[model samples]
Target: MTTQLLSRWKRSAIGSQLCLDLRSPQAYQIRHVAPSTNIPWQQLSLRCAELPPKNVPFAVIEPSDQKPDTCSQWLIERGWQCPYVFREDDDTFWTAVEQYSQPTTPKPWLLFRPCPFLMQHINWIEKQTQQHRCLDIGCGSGRDVAWLLSRQPLWNVYALDSLKGAVERTHQLTKNMGVHDRLVECLQAKITSEGKWKTFDEDSPAVTAKNNTTATAGTSPTSGTTTTINNTIAITNGDIDDKSRRFSPGVSTDTFFQDKLGCSQFDLILTIRFLVRSLLPQLPQLLAVGGYLVISHFVEDGVHEYEQPRKDHRLQLGELAALYGSMANIEIVVDVIEQIEDGRPVNSVVIKRTGP
Candidate 1:
């Protein structure tokens, strides 16, 4: 069986310092799979040097399982020096399992990003976001929240969730991770929903009604008796002025440093595997003047032959990158990755907003 040969080949490959696979001539011509090759049986005698340094175990994986009995007998009599043969019917499951058991991954905190995607390219982003304040949006069970905090204990974490029991569960999870203090109480606010916060037009009507009644202001000239101007109108020229209307200053995260109940101020923000169109454009503003952003998510490539994105809120391919185009410190991420060094399939990008 092929498994038995691979078992022996894996062992023999250890001391030789080189492992080569000569699979098929056609396969080599088409894709030329990296680290795998095809060495024709007839030409190998003249091309043995074309194979790799014999300093390591050199293997020739051929598609042939049947050979002349005399050919088998001749190779059999040649001792252990003959190239290991990998045939088509060889069941390689056991051999792959044996090789997979070896230690992999840079460290153990990456079980969440456990695919050959995003985490493979995370080193630079990780190094940049570590020491800053961060918020992990859509933190389901706090697994990623815990992983990020575990790497940098000094960083403050605002773990947010919109589910019914998400806040409580995040509390329990972070407590289990022994990082409750670093984690701010879970925010139960829904990032979506137009009614989550009272709209300006809706909120303004109440204030306008109030101002019309009791608030004393310079009166408009009646005609003959009074000739005075009234500039105290709540609506400026029939439009609501953001500066004049009680600007909610809307729950900014900046209050943290002032020892006040902060509105959500963070030096860095992270959202992974989640999308909301309204939130996309505001990503640049969430950070402080010089804040950084790290976002990773599933993006379409415009090629999948399905109904295309149009007149909808869902992000299309390259949409996330385009959102911050005019921003002073914007960096857009593209998903065309060259290396699979990390064990996951991921699309990730880091944006740094330089201070004005």
Candidate 2:
């Protein structure tokens, strides 16, 4: 299709329904049309199943080196309606869209900074194989998730948190950074007990369903929201028991996390600033052979003063390492207690699974 025609179509209401950017995540990062869901050309075949229904009209923004006809033909064969493909060289399309600009300086928020320990060991991480999958447990606001996505073509991050607001914030950060292509998934879940995780579905009857609200799937990532493809299953009905502070369940929570993760093993699993001792035993099972586990959390040192004196939440010296002492086929890369510039003493451990 001609650039002018595509541009005019994009302005129409129908065009707003589905606009895809069929460029590499790297290319999309450099420049892409706003509101377009980015699914890299290389991943199109693998992810096409997640696209909107066949009846929905969609358009694709192809790279300069790719043939528009070839891409459209591939999609057509896979049940996608004839998709409008616009080449990168189309000046009219490029001139009509707004390009994202990178910030000249770092922001002051600590939430935006990558953990010092992660940064220090990034060289070791890069030396491993490509296309690694990482899971961030208790991923508040998803600082680490954003960092992993920034290392695109290398890592696919899955972030989880119990707070709905935190999960939503992570989605916003991923959208703002234009790295939705690298984020595997972000879920609202809680690791409440050993080997048991629960996920909250807002569309459940106890929440939006009772109101007769219909939930739509295949939402644009840039729309500042994230949702699952399956809306059928939900952990809770939104009824919270006051004494226990837990939501009333509508379904079993046993396999909810695994179902959402879509994998039993991950290349890396990170838990930062949040500690759950119950999850320690399952770390070995979650990590693939040669996979790494990085965890960092606050420690109770008499020298440091705290606003809240919750000793149970603070780790004792060498306590973090002791939890993994019985785990087999793992090598400890780094285990130490260090005080950051902020005066918080943290126990950080980086271990690698060496056996199947």
Candidate 3:
């Protein structure tokens, strides 16, 4: 990487991102970037598996004489986004280091940091079967989507948002995190919209047949009749052709969810800050037997700092729990209404779908 570009990256928000110091432990202990992770160069091969997700921005810092070209090549071949190297002797190296400062507050990119409640119950989640599928409703900027993918690298994650920007941001963020494009599918569309779901042929070039199969397996059994249409549009490196962007699966949210993701249900469904009351009734249909559903959002308390004018949008005390309590198929695992450190009254519930 050029010094100018390196300097620019260092000055930007990406600079505070993770860094990998490839020096020996003793060398790293003596002097290294303030917030970098040390995985000595010689041990990189053994410890490479421990590296963060590809979407995370990271740079490799190595000794002056030992270039990591081979190491970089090895990582890139195994799906690690190749990191830029900074030699110890370079003048720009220290400049980049000097500019590094850990973020004091949570940034938008990190907004989906796992909820403390979820963290407390992480053992419950980890005990579930592997290769699980997850859905993130109102996946704004994909914070939770990214978190889920990072936490369960082998799992498939599907994220949806009504806003185009949010969907695009989720896609971009996941891409930046180096998530395999196949592992995540993002859509800009409302979940409640009614329309006939359309299907694509397995041989269609627009999306791989494997992806189509994965998605199709998730559709609801009652989702009724399907039509197969051959979409000739080509996909390159997981990106649709610009001319065919509008017709691409990424843009076809309804079709993607209804048809491509046919009869499929998720092992985990998450609704964070965003809430659509209409979605509550539909949650059961979307969850697999034994799947968990987590929902957290603002509640209607008189202590309004920033008033949510829409009463329908704000939950009443115990309302969140009641929504699931009435469901015979769901078992409420965790339910609480408390003022977090931020002093906002929120209702949170975690429930498991116990029956069909």
lDDT string for model 2 (1-356, tens) is 47556665666565443567777878877776655666767876644433555655677777777765777778788777655677777876676554321232221111124677987987787677454889889887677787777773568888888666567768876765667777888877766544456555444443343433333355443343222212322222221311122232433232554566777688888998887677776777788888889988888877888754377888888786776765779888899888665567888999888897
Model 1 / residue 277 / CA error / Å: 1.2
- Candidates' lDDT values, in order? 0.46, 0.66, 0.61
**Candidates ranked, most accurate by TM-score first:** 2, 3, 1
lDDT of 3 by residue, 1-109 (tens): 4566566556656434656767776876666666666666786664443465554455667665575465566667777654566776676667656655453322122
Judged by TM-score, which candidate is best? 2
Candidate 3 least-lDDT 10 residues? 234-243
Q: Which ten residues in a row have the lowest lDDT in candidate 2?
A: 235-244
**Candidates ranked, most accurate by lDDT first:** 2, 3, 1
TM-score preference between candidates 1 and 2, better one: 2
Expressed as tens digits, the lDDT of each residue in 103-209 for candidate 1 is: 33232212122222334544555565534677776676666666556564366777665442445556765564466777764654434332121112225333443
The lDDT leader among the candidates is: 2
- Residue 58 of model 3, lDDT score: 59
Stretches of model 3 off by over 4 angstroms after superposition: 1-112, 192-256, 302-305
Q: What are the candidates' C-alpha RMSDs?
A: 22.1, 15.7, 13.6
